[model samples]
Target: DAGVTQSPTHLIKTRGQQVTLRCSPISGHKSVSWYQQVLGQGPQFIFQYYEKEERGRGNFPDRFSARQFPNYSSELNVNALLLGDSALYLCASSLEQPRGNTIYFGEGSWLTVV
Candidate 1:
């Protein structure tokens, strides 16, 4: 089965434009989570959706949000983005905990804010 996948391997935007990142989870999986990884820092959890329901949320500001689809795919939306938002946006999927040990990540959507 295909592993988790993310789109627009890289992106660049001004300080206020919104961006939507996509993710498709492994077959049969029903959970997807979003994370932001700044340069030299570990990935920080953003939002997690399982079975189309919000499962957990991290300390991210209101600008960060995400949703899971019926097919187990997901999308992350960041509004009124900031320069500090420049980072590697990672998407991870799992079969259980969502935050479980079996989680796997994508190559990430690298965003650069100018």
Candidate 2:
């Protein structure tokens, strides 16, 4: 089975623009989470979806949104982009089990705002 995959490994956008990033979870995984990582800091949680419904969200601004498809794939959308929004967007998938949700992350989509 393939690992989680994210699209547009890299991108460049100007301030005030909008961007969308896509992700496909590993087979059998039912939950997808999104995170943002600045160069030196750890990833900041953004959103999580399970069974195609939003399970949770972070303290991000209203401009950030995400959704999961029926097939478990997911997309992250950001509007009114700012230079501060330039970071690595990560996608992780987890199999919610009795033990715990074991999350696996993809390389991430690198977004650079001008």
Candidate 3:
């Protein structure tokens, strides 16, 4: 059984461009979450979806959006990319249980905006 998988291991973009990142959860997982990690800092939660519906969101600009499909796969989109947006985008998946449940993370998509 594979853990969470993310596409496009690395990406480079200019300011004002847009990018989309994808993720697939492990089998039997029903929840997918997205996070942004800057250098030397912890990941910041971007969004969380469960059963194809959005359950939570973090303090990100409107340019950041995400959706989960019926199969529990997810995608994260960022528009008007800025230099500050350059970071590692991580996807995590877990069971739709209590808050303390263990969550699995993908290798992450590295994005650099110049």
Model 1: how far residue 105 lies from native, Å = 0.7
Candidate number of the best lDDT: 3
Candidate 2 residue-wise lDDT at 61: 95
| Candidate of highest TM-score | 3
Provide the lowest-lDDT 10-residue window in model 1: 93-102
How do the candidates rank by lDDT, highest first?
A: 3, 2, 1
For all predicted structures, in order, the TM-scores are 0.95, 0.96, 0.97
Model 2 / residue 103 / CA error / Å: 0.4
Model 3 misses residue 61 by how many Å? Answer: 0.6
- For each candidate, the alpha-carbon lDDT, in order, equals 0.90, 0.94, 0.94
Whole-model lDDT, candidate 1?
Answer: 0.90
Q: Which one wins by lDDT: 2 or 3?
A: 3
Q: Compared with the true structure, what per-residue lDDT tens digits does model 3 show for residues 11-97?
A: 999999999999999899999999999999999999999999999999999999999998999999999999999999999999873
In order of TM-score, best first, we have: 3, 2, 1
What is the per-residue lDDT of model 2 for residues 1-114, given as tens digits with 9 covering 90 to 100? 899999999999999999999999989899999999999999999999999999889999999999999999999999999999999999999986213757999999999999
